[model samples]
Target: QQQVRQSSQSLTVWEGETAILNCSYENSAFDYFPWYQQFPGEGPALLIAIRSVSDKKEDGRFTIFFNKREKNLSLHIKDSQPGDSATYFCAASPNYNVLYFGSGTKLTVEP
Candidate 1:
């Protein structure tokens, strides 16, 4: 079974609005979670990350909310803009190496 999973296939949000992307994982050994964003034709880039010791992580307009007990997490994009439109992936790593990625969620930010 896949260790990481993303529930939404796509999400749409107007400019300046917030977009929420949900994800879950099955491995308790997974401790580090990172969200990656990829523009069309470009490779995924690490956007933000959170550790099991922290429930929340924020970087600029991106934030991650993690639930260690539920083995789930969510990425929140604030003040979303058209440039923020991309395919977002939720990834996890147990030993800080060999990441397992979710199916990904396509986020379209409309002006």
Candidate 2:
């Protein structure tokens, strides 16, 4: 069974609004969580990450809120822009080993 899961297939946000992408995992063994952003005809790139020991991690415009007990996490994009539109994937690794990726959430930032 897949360990990581993304409930939403797609999400839309107006420019300058914040977009929240939700994710969850079934494996308690999973500790490290990383989110990947990918554009069309391109490979996924690492956006931000959080460990089991951390409840939150933040980058420039991206932030991750994690709950170890709930086995869930969310990626918040502040001041979403049209360029921020992409397919975001939630991935988890156990002991820094193989990574399991979720289906992915497609985000569209409308102007």
Candidate 3:
């Protein structure tokens, strides 16, 4: 009950377009949720996060929509660009520890 099923393949987004990545979980014990934004050869940065107690989270051009009842979540990027292109991962932890990360989404924002 500690698994986060994420997209195995990468995604491509054009400039000024919104990219949506998907994630889901089978475990109900998960409580802490976080979405990480990563660039080439760099560790993921904590973009935005939301708890199961909450519904949604947003930060700047990034937004996370979570559904506790459905046990699913998604990340929406506004104004997609070449610079905004990168790999994104959705992660969750039980008791705020032992994070389970998604495979990853490779987003190429073309110009």
Candidate 4:
């Protein structure tokens, strides 16, 4: 069964604007949420993450807004750039090691 879901398969944003990627999960047991960013020919890297206990997490230009009660989250990329174009995956885990991923959202930052 698919435990995670991304609302859009692709998203486009103009440079300097904010790009939002949305995700939701089925299992309430999923406590850790991590968003991974992948560029062409490169493996997905951990972009940012949030625990169930917190409503949000931020790292540099990336921010994850989480809603525990709703079981949904959104990743916001501030000041979108052409170099930020990539596929983003939203993943969840009961523990840190094992992750269930959503169908990725391809982000296009137009310059």
Best by lDDT: 2
Candidate 1 clash pair list: none
How does residue 110 of candidate 2 score in lDDT? 99
RMSD of 1: 0.8
Query: What would the per-residue lDDT of candidate 3 be over residues 1-111, giving only the tens digit for each residue?
Result: 438978556888789999999999978999988988899899999888989988878889888899999999999999987888888889998895588998888889899
Give the Cα lDDT of each candidate. Answer: 0.95, 0.96, 0.87, 0.95
Compared with the true structure, the alpha-carbon lDDT of candidate 4 equals 0.95
Candidate 2 Cα lDDT to native: 0.96
Candidate 1 local distance difference test against the native: 0.95
Q: How far is candidate 2 from the true structure (C-alpha RMSD, Å)?
A: 0.7
Residue pairs whose backbone atoms clash in candidate 3: 10-106, 11-106
How do all the candidates rank in terms of TM-score, highest first?
2, 1, 4, 3
Model 1 C-alpha lDDT per residue in residues 12-107, reported as the tens digit of each score? 999999999999999999999999999999999989999999999999999999999999999999999999999999999998669999999999
- Candidate 3 — worst ten consecutive residues by lDDT sum? 1-10
What clash count does candidate 4 reach? Answer: 0
Candidate 4 lDDT, 54-111, residue by residue in tens: 9989999999999988999999999999999999999999965789999999999999
